[model samples]
Target: MNNAVTIVRVSLNDANTLLELSRKTFFDAFLSTNNPADMEAYASTAFTLPKFQFELINPNSAFYFALVDNEIAGYIKLNYVDAQTELQDPDALEIERIYVLNDFQGQQIGKQLINLAIQTAVDKNLKYIWLGVWEHNTKAIKFYRSKGFEQFGSHPFMLGSDKQTDILMKKEL
Candidate 1:
């Protein structure tokens, strides 16, 4: 792949594309280590058209698609203020989701997406950026740590009926 990557802000009209990519990337990332029933249940509800539509239109939430050579290779979701899943800090930005296609891993696509998120937060004068990663995802935790994010807390995440722990990490700007 060439070094021709671009991050495009997702719009309402891109709901269908976003939904499909969201489901595909989420499944590729977690399906292997998770229960099939739980994965299916979560995907059915979380990756639907209506859900994407709502998120796409939400004023405090933003989504972006990372395109490599004009093909969607990854995506990121950011939530601000009340739209944040946990701490509703107006001065903070929450990275609710960041996923890169399995085929696109080890290509720095994830890092590029993260840089975009950091730029976005800085542009808004946000105090800090925070995110939740599954505790068992050591790779992701290491990545976040490399970006200067420190573990601050943890919260329970529901993957369908299964409750799991997500380590909260944050980077102070």
Candidate 2:
């Protein structure tokens, strides 16, 4: 694929494509490390078209897709204010999700998506950006640290019936 990647804001019209990509990337990233039943259960509820459509239209949230040569390679979801999954701090932005296709993992698309989130927070004068990374996702933790994030706390994340811990990390803008 081309090294040049572009980020585009996701709209209601793109819900189907977004849902497909979301399910694919999420499964690719975590399925092997998680129970099949738990993964399927979570995906069934989380990746539905109606769910994606609702998210796309939410005023306090935004989604963006990374395109490599016009093909969808990844996506990022940002939540602000009351829409944040945790903390709900008005001055902070929460990166609710960020995933790249397995085929595109080694590329810098993930970094570009993160930079976009940072810029968005800065543009809005937000004090910081935060996200929850699965405790076992060491690669992601390292990536966030390289971008100046530090672990603040952790919270339980329910992957279907499985209770998992997610390390909360934050970076001040």
Candidate 3:
């Protein structure tokens, strides 16, 4: 077990670990929803094992993990998204996902991830860092706000077998 937390690029072999972390983090983040089926589907689909593995090995995408004591405490995904259909700057780098384990909540792990994403985006010469967060995720929304993210637009998202909306947030680096 390491004393200090470490963030590192994930490898294809870490797929199973990533899925497990996603499941735990999603359930923890959305405990108020109380919808097991929806949670399971999300953890297995958007954060599926195969997809996680692909991102780990993908040249165009970078997935980072916060490791504590050699165990994954949280993870973040960064990738490019075409902005042709949106108002956002085409040079913005999309932060696809950020999730922390249940027990790690409220420990500033999320902020750490955000800072990492901003640094990564800047390193790639991206103009901004963007992410889509569930409108219902008030905690996340507030966290983003505290980190200087402003609402840019809305996007459709699936939740509990129903269509929902998510707010797109952006932070200029």
- For model 3, residues 1-173, the per-residue Cα lDDT tens digits are 22467899887877887777777777877866757787666565776777667667766677789887787889988776542224445577787788888787777777888889888778878888878888888988999999999998998987667677989998988
Candidate 2 lDDT by residue in tens digits, 74-118: 999999999998899999999999999988887999999999999
Which candidate leads the pack in lDDT? Answer: 2
Error of 3 at 31 (Å): 4.3
The model with the greater TM-score, 1 or 3, is 1
- Model 1, 1-173: lDDT tens digits are 55778999999999999998888888888989999999999899888888889989999999999998789999999999999998899999999999999988889989999999899999999999999999999999999998999999999999999999999999999
lDDT of 3: 0.78
For each candidate, what TM-score against the reference? 0.97, 0.97, 0.86
Cα lDDT of all candidates, in order?
0.93, 0.95, 0.78
How many pairs of residues in model 2 come into backbone collision? 0
Better of 1 and 2 by lDDT: 2
2 versus 3: better lDDT goes to: 2
Pairs with steric clashes in candidate 3: none
**Global fold similarity of model 3 (TM-score):** 0.86
Q: By lDDT, highest first, what's the ranking?
A: 2, 1, 3
TM-score, predicted candidate 2 vs. hidden true structure = 0.97
Stretches of candidate 3 off by over 4 Å are 1-3, 81-90
Model 3, position 129, has a per-residue lDDT of: 81
